[model samples]
Target: MVLIIFFTSLAGNALMICLIHWDHRLHMPMYFLLSQLSLLDMLLISTMIPKMAADYLTGKKSTSFIGCGLQIFFFLTLGGGECFLLAAMSYDCYVAVCHPLKYSVLMSWPLCLRMTLGSWLLGAADGLMQAVATLTFPFCGRREIYHFFCEAPTVLHLACDNTSLFEYLMYICCVLMLLFRFALILTSYGLILATVLCMPSTDAHQKAIATCSSHLAVVSLHYGTVIFMYVRPKTYKTTNYDKAVSAFYSILTPHAEHPHLQSEE
Candidate 1:
């Protein structure tokens, strides 16, 4: 099942990336950002899924200390980058819809490039902080992680020394980042809604609403599962259901960016 999910995601995201790269008509800022997202999704899922499939198939669950650290680093960095990118995409949509006249000028190529790069950089910085905190702690005995992936909370639970400070700090950072991004998403959509409502052309209003609806669906899926996985109570029991939820956004959402599908509309 894990293998099935892994390959399916891998193929789907790869196809999206190919489609975006092959089509010159899809070179707009929206599609460009989405292509970056597709690339990230491919990289992010590949980081853990292949190892997981090998482990599951071979019944070998052990990961070296260094391997575990690298997994955590890439997982958190890519995951955080995705969240920031989605928020940026939402802002792009809001600007395009609410202020169509200025959209091109505001979201220029340079600004878009910076925003994309900045998201990754910020995510890497956050991951670095977490990695430092994680590696500094002593691990005396048990190192078995219940989850297939090396998640920070699960790893922290296994530490022999106190991780309360590190965990608390991580929680603070997660909450602040999530809250700020959620607020930005909501504010952008609010302005978009107001603009759509005031627009006299019914057809234009409908088109705007349709675009927003698609974005809202993607946002809900991505943010909802992440919040559920991280914010909920941490337990030792292994659950396939959690993996399924993670797979949804990480694996499925990138396929929506395919140029063929986008062009069909």
Candidate 2:
């Protein structure tokens, strides 16, 4: 099941990227953002899935310190980028639906490129900060991480020193990354809904709803698991349940987002 999801997500995202690149019709701002999404999803899945599959197949569940750090860095980089990218996508939808006349002016190619670049930079910054901070802690005995990947929380849990202060700091960062972006998405869609309801044409309402629905679905899947994993109360720490939720977002969310690619196509 894991391998199947890995290959499917990889192929689907790669194909989406290719189609957008080669097909001129898909060269619009919306598809451009989508292609960036495909690229991010592809990179994100590749960061962890290959190593995870190899570990599962060979029964060797160990990674070097460097390998683990790289995993955490790339995981946070791509994951954080996706959060911002999803917010940008919602704003794109809002502009296209509510302010169609200014969409080209508002979401132009250069603006899209800037948005994409900003997402990558922000995500990389977060990843670098967290990776350095997380790794600086001295990991003591019984370093067997309970989760499948070197997720920051799982690894942080092994610190020999007091991490309560660091965990609080991390929680604040997570809130800013996850909740802030989610709130932007909701606000964008809220405006979209208001605009749609005011439209006299039923066709316009249907079209706007149809376009936004896929994005909402993808956002729900991605944010639900991540918020549960990172933002939920630390008191709710169950290793097994954490592993299950981690697998859900790591493997399943990308697959779920693939259908949106087809819908856009």
Candidate 3:
């Protein structure tokens, strides 16, 4: 099942990227951002699923310390980037739909580039800080992470030192990362809704609704699972349920994102 999802996500996202790249009509800011999203999804799922599948097949659940740290770094980096990228995509959609005449100027190539670069930088910064902080603590006992991947919270569970304060700090970071961007998405869509309603043509309203619905579905799936996983109290015990949620966002969400990317084109 893991291998199947892994291959499907890879193929789907790769295909989205290629289609956007090869199609001249898709050279607009929206598709450019979608292609960047596809690329990020490709990297995001690849960061964890490949190693996970390998472990599942080989019966080797254990990874070296450095390997674990690297996994967390890349996973958080891509995940964080996707969060910001989705917000940027929402704004692109807003500008395109609500201010079509100004889209060319507002969502210009340089601005798009800046947004993409900003997403990556912010994500990298979060990933680096979390990875370093989570791994630095002294871990005792068997040091086995209950979860499938080296997620920051799961890894922090093994720490011998007191981490309550740090866990609260992590929670705050998750809130800022997830909720703040989610608020941006909501604001963009709210404006979109108001604009769509004022349109005289029913056909135009319907089309706008259809497009926005698809984007919102992708956002809900991604954000809902991530917030459920990371935004909770540290006192919460890790369970198979947590693993399932992780799989949803880490594996399934990327696959879900593919259709939305293709639909944009």
Give the C-alpha lDDT of model 1: 0.76
For model 2, the superposed segments whose C-alpha errors exceed 4 Å read 254-265
Please list the C-alpha lDDT of all candidates, in the order they appear: 0.76, 0.85, 0.84
Q: Rank the candidates by lDDT, best first.
A: 2, 3, 1
Task: Looking at model 1, report the run of 10 residues with the lowest lDDT sum.
Answer: 256-265
Clashes of each: 0, 0, 0
TM-score ranking of the models: 2, 3, 1
Question: lDDT score, residue 233, model 1?
Answer: 49
Per-residue error (Å), model 2, residue 190: 0.4
Clashing pairs in 2: none
RMSD of each: 3.5, 3.0, 2.9
Q: State, as a TM-score between 0 and 1, how close model 3 is to the true structure.
A: 0.94
Candidate 1 per-residue lDDT, tens place, 80-118, comes to 898898888888888678667777798888989999999
The sequence of per-residue lDDT tens digits that candidate 3 reaches over residues 67-138 is: 999999999999999899999989888887787777789889999999999999999999999999998899
lDDT by residue (92-175, candidate 2, tens digit) is: 888888888777898898989899999999999999999999999998899899778899989988899999999999898898
Q: Work out the TM-score per prediction.
A: 0.88, 0.94, 0.94
